[model samples]
Target: MLDGLIISIDAMGGDDAPDVVIKGLEYFLKTTGKQRKARFLLHGDQAAINTLLAKAPLTKARSEIRHSDSSIEMDAKPSQALRRGKGSSMWNAIQSVKSGEAEIVVSAGNTGALMAMSMMILKRKQGVQRPALAASWPNEGGTSVVLDVGANVDADAGQLTEFAVLGEAFYRALYKTDRPRVSLLNVGTEDQKGNAVIKAAHERLSESQLGLNYIGYVEGSDISLGGAEVIVTDGFTGNIALKTAEGTAKLVGRYMKDALQGSWWSKFTAFLNMRALLALKKRIDPSGFNGAVFLGLNGVVIKSHGGTDAKGYANAVNIAIGLAESDFLQTIDVTLEALHDEDDNIGFIK
Candidate 1:
């Protein structure tokens, strides 16, 4: 078996905290049947967790509890929480990962709070200017990794290029892509089109010796079509693109359902097409793409949707475990170091 993978979960993080989080843990343990190898550090009220466990006992006794009486509110300023809420569940969970008690940390808490706590506790990797939130979105061919999903809203071209390098390393480690294609999200596909920042980033990415297949610029529509395996952008644009895609998917799904049920003949056709529809749904299910990994952090930190349900929360925890077991962070560090060295050598040669 892979080395022990400990996932630190903020039991009081999400909208349906404690209950949903507990249920998710139970579900994962029962379904995976590897509860012994995969353990959890549930950070919250010991009494509350014990009460829940008593009602619904876990099969494995590997799970541990770290008591935290307080919870950081979703709206609370992340910096303030990092400074003041040291005893909160979110802080404690990240701390466990930072201290090496846990290999990965998963939280369905305040995104800002988790990001802040991770930056403060685990710290950024060497040579990383800023940590970024990287998430995978389902596409036609496969999943695509989008970096700075909500981490650094204001980023320069150099930072965007760094994101590209980080993303390429992540995909290489996890997805095993030979040379991951990296693209900068832009309004137009042309190399000369976009603001000064985009043009500068395009030039840097084109000229950089990162060994990635920098595929020029890609538009928002390319996201769903798998235009590039790794797409890099500032958090502001990335967030807007991600939310727009999600909303469009929802709208299309609803519209199709409504149109199909409008008449008896259409309803009959819908019944006939149910299998195909289900297949499409499975392809685009958000739960399958739940966790947003915080790359460039010293420790693995997964940010789940604040409104995630039991299944969604469980998926995030599972992702964290898989990433830790896969040793993605260490592999990313090594790959980035090699890229940096190559870049430095080229500079020296010139």
Candidate 2:
């Protein structure tokens, strides 16, 4: 158990605001919070949060409020928000991490705005040129950590290598996987298949003594097929892949529902396989993996889905607590220093 682990949260950042945020914290307290014994610092309008906290006994008992009169709008541009975001809930929430008063910060706010504030407040870890945003992808075996999801639109070989290191540590911390297999996301798996940048990164990982489980390359289909445990790619390709997979999942779910109720015969068959269908449904629920961590940052900051429900928010809280307790940042520091040392020994230039 962690001693005095405090998580900072932006109470008014998400679409549901203080309502879902309070409920989510309460839900986490009843479930995982009982064992973790973590506390929260909620940043938002005090009166609004106090009202919601009334119905959430567990969260009320464990949380303290830091009043902020403003919150960044969901559609606000990063540049605009950064100019006028001072003293806002999101800003104050991240400030708690910067002040070393909180181990982690969680927000369901605008992605660009949150990323901007995080970068401005927390900055990047030493030796990390471009920080990467990583999300968990559900696969046949389990979840695979995919990085550079939407941070940097394009990355050179060195940045990609950095992402591999960051993603490897993240996967290890969350899933407790030893030496998770790392692979590049490419059009095909052949050595000569991808463009120059990916091939360069692949070569770098292969020759490095960083002790990563580098497994070459994986195709787009391999994301859900469990081709590798850690998938790496530039943000341009990764963001497209993430959105496409989400859309495809929704489409398949809709089709299944329609088929299940198409006719009496179809409904009867669905009823016969109700248990199996329910299990499958649970396996594909996106809310199970709701938190996306911005790796390479000085402090841990989790980005929850803006439209997520209380259940999804609870899952994000689970991730925040796991990261706060684990040696995730320390692992990254050690591995990154090793990577730099390896580069120096080989006369490699960044």
Candidate 3:
């Protein structure tokens, strides 16, 4: 029900340029099956996109194209990308957000290049040193947020605290959870187990009167065990934690398949439980959670997985539309301003 929501897409950024991107649009339309007020702005090679859009009437009907001849390489360094950024689809897609022609920007591109372009084009919010990459964690009860997931290598205490605030705002806006239990991801649940920066952030979050449900520390094992609704950590550890969790999930799945197909009896038992197994797979599939939000940016920017297919990419687009329609940026602005005043400069959004 948004008035004029327009989402910008970098059609050339993904692995299957324009092909998967157009299918992603069709997937969205077919899945939703409802006429939406939102529009699409695609930046890519016009001829290439036109060829793909032939099969995607819903997207072609409500979309416009901005032609760009080039695309940033998947392995391109950030400096190389920034130097040759002009006229690239990724750059133009981000420019649409900067020009206010789009409410949100979505890219299935190189994370580093996309982040670099987003930072240069949209800049960070006031009082934010480096924006964090926030993503959803499939917790036991429902979902929770984990922040600083590969945004920066490391962060100081103040930066970590700011990441917590940004992640809190993200969780609140997306999940509509009030007073979410904020917790620091540490090696152990004890107060004295983490590094100096994490320890400092823990103390700050605990002592602040910012009205957050600060619940101290949680170990990596406790993250999916529903330890807290918002988990905060530096980029280095958070990235490793997330990747490890994903790898472990895949390992468990592989083991289950191997065991199920080992013997005739095992195969029969597996057949009996196929429905339950499929349900479990659907529950924990990573493709459904393909979007990673760039928090603390001046505008809404989402990074979809580079290898995601049409279905996965559709979820990313859905997240973009949901965030835009909910005015999540306004929620972040208001939340930070209030927390900043209440915590005597502890929360950084000034």
Candidate 1 Cα deviation (angstroms), residue 89: 0.7
lDDT by residue (tens digit), candidate 2, 1-350: 12389999999989999788888899889987788779899999999999999999989888899999899999999999999999999999999999999999999999999999999999999999989989988998888788889988999998999999999999999999998999999999989999989888888889998899999999999889899999999998999999899999989999999999999999999999999999999888888889899999999999999998888899999999998889999989999999888878877655
Quick one: ranking by TM-score, best first? 2, 3, 1
Can you write out model 3's per-residue Cα lDDT over 59-127, one digit (the tens) per residue? 888789889989998889989999998889999999999998899999998899999999999999876
Candidate 1 vs candidate 3: the lDDT winner is 3
Each prediction's RMSD over C-alphas, in Å, is 3.0, 1.8, 2.6
lDDT of each: 0.82, 0.92, 0.85
TM-score of each: 0.91, 0.97, 0.93
- Number of the top-ranking candidate, with TM-score as the measure: 2
TM-score winner between candidates 2 and 3: 2
How close to the true structure is residue 233 of candidate 2, measured as C-alpha lDDT?
A: 97
- TM-score of candidate 1 on Cα atoms, chains taken together: 0.91
Give the per-residue Cα lDDT of candidate 1 at 26.
Answer: 81
**Where does model 3 exceed 4 Å of error?**
1-3, 33-35, 263-269, 342-350
Better of 1 and 3 by TM-score: 3
